[model samples]
Target: MGRAFVYVILGGGVAAGYAALEFTRKGVSPGELCIISEEPVAPYERPALSKGFLLPESPARLPSFHTCVGANEERLTPKWYKEHGIELVLGTRVKSVDVRRKKLLTATGETISYKILLIATGARALKLEEFGVDGSEAENVCYLRDLADANGLVNVMQSCSSGNAVVIGGGYIGMECAASLAINKINVTLVFPEVHCMARLFTPKIASYYEEYYQSKGVKFVKGTVLTSFEFDSSGKVMAVNLRDGSQLPADLVVVGIGIRPNTSLFEGQLTLEKGGIKVNGKMQTSNDSVYAVGDVAAFPVKLFGETRRLEHVDSARKSAKHAVAAIMEPKKSGEFDYLPFFYSRVFGLSWQFYGDNVGEAVHFGDYSSGTFGAYWISKGHLVGSFLEGGTKEEYEAIAKATSLKPPVEDLAELGQQGLNFALTISKKPQPALPIEVSRSTSGLVLEKPVYAWHAAAGLVLTASIAGFAYWYGRRRRRW
Candidate 1:
């Protein structure tokens, strides 16, 4: 004998929490919806684990960062789930799923069936052992992915205050963790195989600004090298790290942020895979009619780029999860998911936001030395992407609007001179408002301020366009 639900959401991460909230909003009946998660607690914002949660003082804890709160929406605590009659199967793992029968077999030997299922298994951090280096089993080594991992890192940080820490991997986790360590008065040396940090997103010039800031904080960098091995003390704590460049750095603790892989192993044979994630349609529906995928595990069509992408950012996870639920509940009204790639991070009094693709020639602007700078990417004479640091709320909205429109650029030199002015002008021009429902799904554009309708004649009379072109002609510099 077993229980069943009309809807079963797999995975208790950001996506699961958002999906649950969406279900409640769509009027899911009592006892009809259930969430199964290995995590004992309800979904909280996962990004906080790497940011506010790691603060040296007054650190953020669970219940303070739950789902929807990141988006400035209602916080969905476990109590919220219970009050809405949604079943919370916490600390439970689904051992197997039989799509044909629409049944999930839990590790506890209970069978829970569902008419429709949402897969949101998220991803797991890649361990150092996978790279042929063993010793991650040491007590001082840490990886931040879940609440438990965050707690463990805090414990390690407390014990290793004023000591040296080696951070492996220069990506998001490595950068953020290093900053946190430094804030805690720990000496940090960041190691990576790339010439500059955040190599995938930030151009060398942009990276330089951050590298300098970190250096100011006494964080040393080891580039173009990888970790060879780790030396452990008799107590099995990491004592030092060996690099490929024949240098050894003493370490009181180590943090590994190599990367992560989506939890798609369960659906390997059961679902079609693409780009290392479960392939889904514009509606976030998998190949199976009864199953849908969301979050980092779903490779769904990105209408903005006219391609399918498996985005690993928290914004993508939250929006995709909500979209999947909307498609499931309001099929007739729900349209295709139209998403614009958005990414942002905040560390050590620095914050930045990027919208759209990073392709094409990049034109940087602003005073880099002043901690206020930005860049725009032009592809085939159209502005396709924008990045800004230390921007106000209005400025961020301006860039988002400009990138979405993809305005044509006559000259690259003028764009650099105009810099933030170009986006500001575009934001003031009249433009069509996105549909109420559609605008909410897309990133970076929705705002409390009213959207202005386009004034064709006024747009043509704008002088910034001409000045921008001429400025670029006189000030064009070598691309970094």
Candidate 2:
């Protein structure tokens, strides 16, 4: 048998949830939209899987961390979808897709047709087996990705209480999971081939601060080494991990988070691919006019950086999904999507936020010992990126605004001396307001002129006219 929908969203992820919300907001009728996902439950914030969900006490659960809530919007729970009359085809995988026919063949021998489609398959976490090291199937060897993975990790954590735990990789998952394991009273030994953790983003100087903090928390670091093999016990549980440096560490539990690969295998020949992801336009539309892509699987153009990038962060997924929906529903009103890259993390009592591209000369500021420090990246005499820790809400906003504006820097020394003040001053300056547009009615009467003004101090926009004035607040774009 076959089913049909006016719009269909593939891959139940952050993008899919946000797309569903946007579609409903744009006045989608009941039964007109459907979301097909291999996940058994509705979409929840994926970032939470690495952070709050792993807490030792009262960990975050479903419905609490569902979609839209991450953006401070209404939470889209399973009930919410039902109330909206939106169908959620959970635990169902699309075996094949026919873009020309706008049909999807489910794994269970069902054909689903749609007029328009959104692809948000996201990515899958890389396993140690891919690196040629076996024992990934061991009961205690865990890799966090979905709800099932998180639940498995939690069970392993509980079973290995106060035991030695080995965390592989130095990326977001490794660092966050290590912190969680340490908090759970487990001896955490984080091993990675890089000289330091978060090698892709944090510089040596920035990494030093976190390394010191983690050390103080009893988390050991084994840098410049890779796992060559795993030693398992009679019960098929990982007991130790052998490293490339000719070293072996006792491991009652193993958590691997090397990296992720975009889920683009399904559309390899059917769609244009770039940067290891499906190619899409500013509107998130793929090469096929009726199909679109978003999340980690879509390599859309980055206007600020002037290049196509496949961002594997949740913020891009959410914004791109909403933009795609807007473009589909209100093609005449929707403009090109403009996004500023953002990333953040929280471990123990520490939290930090990074905005814009990280390139060019780096300037360090603040005191590291006191737990307040930040850095600015200057490229071509303009501030291109800003990173801050232990910053106030307004200070974070100032840095984000300055990074987006790309304020000119005359001297590196002066910029360092000025520190956060520079961003604050730049943020204080007023932005050019959009010119008021006026139109005439068919009766030759002048219609009310609409004034579009930016409120810099509040980071909001005011749309005023003879009829009324409405304030539109901007949301902070953040990724895990």
Candidate 3:
């Protein structure tokens, strides 16, 4: 037997969850939509895997960190999906996708057909095997990507509490996990080849602020080197990690976050690829009209930068998914997916938010010694990006708005001197359409945007509330 649906979302992650919520919000009919995911549970916030999920106390779990909920929206639990008549084929992977036939063949020997398709396959974490290292499958070795990976990591962390843990990678995953492990009382030694952590996004000065804080917590940094091999015990557990610098860090557990590869294998040759991901238009629609891609798999135009980028972050995933749905539902009035990239992370007691691109010259501002400080990236004589640490919702919004405006940077020295004052005054000159603010709790751990700071989580809330959707042609024609 086969199942037919008006809309089928392939892959259930953050994007799938948010898309399902949007569908329900726009008045979807029962049995009209289905989400096929490899995970047994419905979509949850994937970031928690590296942050709250590994905490020593009140570790985040299912339903608690569900998608949309983080945005202060209704959490889409499996029960909720059932109530909405949305099918969830969890624990089933799509073996192949026939875009022309509008059918997806599952590894379970099931064929599902859809009048319209949305691909939210997301991405897979890079493995140690790919980096010439072995024993990633060891019991103590962990990689955080989804619920299962997080659960496995928590289990390993618990068993190896107060033990030495080696974390590979210096990006978001590395920093956040390193903090979590330290809080859990595990000795953390972070290894990355970058001169400092978060090299791609953070300036040397900004990176120093975080590095100092991490150092205070006894987190060691092994920079400018990569993991070469792993020493495993007879039980197939990684006991230590050998690095390229001819050094070895003893490890009771390993948390790897080198990078991720977009899960676009199924769509190879079936869709146009760009920037290492499936290329899509502003609508997030791929080469095929009936098919759309979102999350880490779709490289769409970034109107803010006048270029295309494949952003592997939760904000892009949620926004792109919702945008694609809106476009499919109402092509004429859905509007273009003009999104400002927002990324944030909470490690220990420090939280930071970044908006726009990190290209061009950077200007440091605020007191670096204190908790509150930031920087702005100027590209082609425009403030194209902003980074803020320990900022109020209003302050964060100021920089985000100012940067997105591509505000002219007349003098670098003057801009540096003014610092936050420049961003604070930017909106008053030329108001950003639908301005947003970034906010969080005083603890500096709760990443919250009180109002329109539609950067990431809060933006998810604002966007969902007013996605400006109309009626899907296929659904309207079928149900009406």
lDDT (Cα, tens digit) per residue for candidate 1, span 122-148: 999999889899988788999999999
Q: Each candidate's lDDT (Cα)?
A: 0.91, 0.89, 0.87
User: Best to worst by lDDT, what's the order?
Assistant: 1, 2, 3
State which candidate has the highest lDDT. Answer: 1
The candidate, 1 or 2, that scores higher on lDDT is 1
- lDDT (Cα, tens digit) per residue for candidate 3, span 302-403: 877667889989999999998998898878989878899999988888888999988778888888767888888887677888999999889988988887
Model 1 alpha-carbon drift over 4 Å, by segment: 432-480
Lowest-lDDT window of 10 residues in candidate 3?
441-450
Writing each residue's lDDT as its tens digit, candidate 2 over 165-203 gives 999998899999999999899999999999889998888
> How well does model 2 score by local distance difference test?
0.89
**Pairs of residues clashing in candidate 3:** 393-438, 436-452, 437-453, 439-448, 454-459
TM-score of each: 0.90, 0.90, 0.89
Candidate 3 is scored at a TM of 0.89
Candidate 3 segments exceeding 4 Å error:
430-480
